[model samples]
Target: MRLSTTQGLGDEPPETNAASSVRKKPDGAKKVNIGEWIDGRYIIEERIGAGGFGTVWKAVESKREEFVAVKEVRHKWLNSPKMLNYFKNEFKVLERLSHESTVCPIDLVRGNGTYLIIMEYLCGGSLSQRLRHSEPLEISTALLITVRMLDVLKACSRLKIIHRDIKPSNILFADKSFEQPKLGDFGLACFKSELLALSPRAIGSEIAGTLTYMSPEQLNGKKLSVKTDIYSLGMTLYKMLTGRLFFDPELLSRAGIKRAILRPFREHPGRYRPDLPYWLDELVMNMISVEPRKRPGDPQAVLDVIERNS
Candidate 1:
């Protein structure tokens, strides 16, 4: 369930590159209709969000009086071998992770040839929704939310789980007050151990991630590491600071995409929000650096950089 605002193809600009052109084609993933029930356990209430890959439903659990978020991959993709692997990978990764700032899967149920994952429901909505309705968040407030996410990434680093997708919509508030933001959606996560097992074969070459926030390595389908997630988080931070996309989505050429991913931005974050510290501009720039080695060593380092500047 990729809730990131960038996931929509309607927002994608005219595509010149043949590679990106294919993105416009129908994915053939079956859509879960509203009011549907799965395995006689989760009664789908409403579709809270959706993306190119899956749809998320706010559901009620039978025999239990609590609300839960059930994420199900598209039925068509479930039948595809490669897509099936990634879907199962999410379940495997989520089961191993337990963190307050990271949403972990509570249960996995399969019926009718589709997989459903149940998770604790967070009602405050996504950061993307908040950013869409309200004015740009105060710098302090954005930083506070970012710091919490950094803590989650720090934990992921320790566990060798790299969350390839990090964008505004994937960040959810734990309650109505919008104080606690937990990172959700592990569908694109890659464990270092799994990569090691594949060794020199190079983990499957399916390009994953939303366009704007996707890192260079992710775009190229190169060998990835923790730094891949750092690059994405950096882009998410860019949105938190500016309340806008870091790049112009209008250009879809290879050069345009490469420039956006591999080249440093000609504009600075401070240009959007003057109140931000000068160090922050550099910190964010480093996070989105073209080279993985140039980014922070780990999420802890990112936290330290923010601390020193704050």
Candidate 2:
């Protein structure tokens, strides 16, 4: 689909986050400007978000007259064959899971010294933006978002895929109305088998996810289960209800984060929004319980509660 470059911080795919997370250096890739044509089909509209690995640009599909987001690999990574393969592999994972809540892949192009992935352009700005400007979202709004997200999580679970990163920034709305909650950015997702084989000693040595929403088990690198996602979703729910993070960003060190996770989590959604009913308050708490066993692993169970509350 061809699309124009709409205003606002467009939905950022996982590659954008990956690019910025890597060492800050010039991303050595060919750059294209506005009005430039790509593959003689899509025309570059504007640079919406930056990714060192694959910079995302808004483009218009000339044939279809629709909007699409294109991600182009940077120059420095061309020699590394693995990067290209990695991009293709992750896209395949996303490309397979088709659903209304998931981002749609339009095209994957192999240009000279670069790779480009075209995705559905999301214009409604992310849930993060909602919290940034106005948080503690309406009770009904939060519940609606949670219910829809539960479906997306269930879809991923059925395929044995674990989206390691499930944060507000990754939850996007299709339009400014914020009625549709679409999940994007699967850069850190993994198949269930990938973690099941990891030995205990290797678990904590390398974990990939946002620390703020990471569950204690994930932070400690224990055998990941569906509960890993439960904790992150609960954390997302908390932010939506209270407009705050479970832990302060200052707790970035390994020891500091571990201690925070192990400590008793005293906060609850009801604490901030006194108007919240007891069931929802309890639901959020149970989902984010420090112990993996305490968190409900069933997405439908959580969805039921959210629907009831909504």
Name the top TM-score candidate.
Answer: 1
**lDDT (Cα, tens digit) per residue for candidate 2, span 1-310:** 2233322222222232222224322343345567877777788898877532456788899899999887765544445454445466557768878879988887666543356777899989889888995468887888888888889889988988888778898898999876898987775577787655333233223225666777777666677877788888888988898887666666468667767767876567676788988998899899989887787868987887776766
Per-candidate Cα RMSD to the true structure, in Å, reads: 7.3, 6.0
Residues 21-69 of candidate 1: C-alpha lDDT, one tens digit per residue:
1333233323445566655666778888766456688888767867889
Model 1 ranges with Cα > 4 A deviation: 1-33, 196-207, 250-255
Candidate 1 matches the true fold with a TM-score of 0.82
List, in order, the clash count of every candidate structure: 0, 9
TM-score of each: 0.82, 0.81
**Residue pairs with backbone overlap in model 1:** none
lDDT of each: 0.71, 0.71
lDDT of 1 at 54: 61
In candidate 1 the C-alpha lDDT for residue 27 amounts to 35
